[model samples]
Target: MKRVLITGGLGFVGSHLTDELMAKGCAVTIVDNLSSNVMTPADYPGCEVLVGSIEEVYPTLLETSKPFDEIFHLASVVGPAGVLQHAGVMAQSIVMSGEAVTRIALQHGSRLVLASTSEVYGRAGELRESDGCQVSSDVTVRLEYAVAKLTSEVAALNRAKVTELQVNVVRPFNIAGPRQLPDGGFVLPRFVVSALSGEPLTVFGDGSQVRAFTDVRDIVSGLQAVMSSGKNGLVLNLGNPANEITILDLAQRVRSLAASKSEITLVDPKALFGPLYDEGIERVPVVEQAFSELDWRPVVSVEQTILSTLDWYRRRLGLSQHESVGVAA
Candidate 1:
């Protein structure tokens, strides 16, 4: 069995990835600072779990968890609120985490996959991996998240050229599904929670903002495929253009699905998130690369994602019927 380490392994996508790897008979070790996921070590009975940020616990990890066969680096400060909270230090934390993972992977000659965000593309529409990113301003906190992630990607790929560090980057577009926290500014979970709660589903701007939401399960599968892609310094886009929908339409769908009396409200984002938030343009990834290179294609429909998220949240809240709220903040 391949021995692997997943930073942020307890978080939404990472936790799902852990389940996948373990099911495949891989020995998995997971570390998370609990910044995003509420899961504890006890939550995962089979895998070894460590609780700390990548920068904080990597040293302990290096000395104790020797010779990892592969590393999945997904830990980073995330979301609009999180970015603004750690503004000046966000890039530093991200780059340091990348370097730490690179060193660990290099020491073991392990395959490494860095989970980069689609936000790096900034404004997007049917985006290819080759398209240049358009982060409006470095000073903007929202854009800073993208710029910082890109910096980490560049550093790792540059190292991959000369070193034995087997590394590739996967840019996932708008991941959504169970266990995704509303705290991270993820739209689908937020909408589902609000719809279940019979609260207004907030649609920022005109709600024409388009997004192609990829399910977390498919994303985890894609991440694993990258490790076997056998190409260093490769960058691939993982998304489902088939699931694309307008923000307003998404809100309406959620309401109908949940059978909620909640009004779909159009509100200024600034009114809710303050000035640091920038929603950017439509996110639509051209996923031909992931399909062509890894033989991977997103199979989950947008409606399935919504229904699954709603069900998960309902279960978490201990609700047998509709009405939900108190999602982790």
Candidate 2:
């Protein structure tokens, strides 16, 4: 059986990747600090989990957990809100996790797959894996997180070359799915929750900002595809290309899908993300490389992803909704 170690294995992308790996009969071990940003352990059972900061525990954990076939480094500071709220942790995690995982993978001869983000592209147009990450001098609140993730990617590549450890980088673009936190700033979840609750949707910047939303299922599948195909020392953009939707359009879809009569209100982007919001615009990925090299292309539609998320959130909320109705004679 193939053994894999996933850092931040309890997070949004990590949890989904864990499920996919388990489904493929891969033995998986998860290490997560579960900072206040997200919950711990999710609902998955029988997962080998180590609960501690990657900084404090990664060296020892890596030493003991050697001889792995592959390591998926998915831990990170995450979104703009995450960086802004936990700047210190973000910086530490970015540096510590990268060093620990890269060193361990090199020592154990484990093929490494690093999960990078399109946010590293910043305001760049039509992102490609060959296009090195864009750096901004602007005091964008999220700059620290982007810089850290980008640096980690470079570090992984350099380590790969020095140690002959096979490494692949996968930069995912705006993945959204069932487990997304409603209170989190992810636009889709926010809109879905607001629509479900009959509350007005908050559309930032006239809802014109465009973003690419891919399903977590597709992302996990893409990672498996890349690793299975024996592709190493390559960077792949794993994301859906056809589904670039505007915030207003996304809100409309949520309202229709949830069957809610909620109003869509426009909010200043500055109010949502502070004044630095206007610094740059993010664009979708060009996945031609993934197609030719790994035979991997996103199969899930944005609409399907949204509807699946809606169903999951609805059930999750229903369980916590009204009081139990059983035995009410």
Which of the numbered candidates is closest to the native, going by highest TM-score? 1
Q: List the residue pairs that clash in candidate 2.
A: none
lDDT (Cα, tens digit) per residue for candidate 1, span 148-172: 8999999999998887778999998
lDDT against the true structure, per candidate, is 0.85, 0.76
Candidate 2 Cα misplacement greater than 4 A, ranges: 36-39, 272-280, 319-329
Q: Per-residue alpha-carbon lDDT of model 2 for 70-102, expressed as tens digits? A: 888887666645556665457667877888887
CA lDDT, candidate 1, residue 134: 78
- Quote the lDDT for 206 in model 1: 92
Highest lDDT: which candidate? 1
- Segments of candidate 1 deviating more than 4 angstroms: 321-329
Model 2 earns a TM-score of 0.90
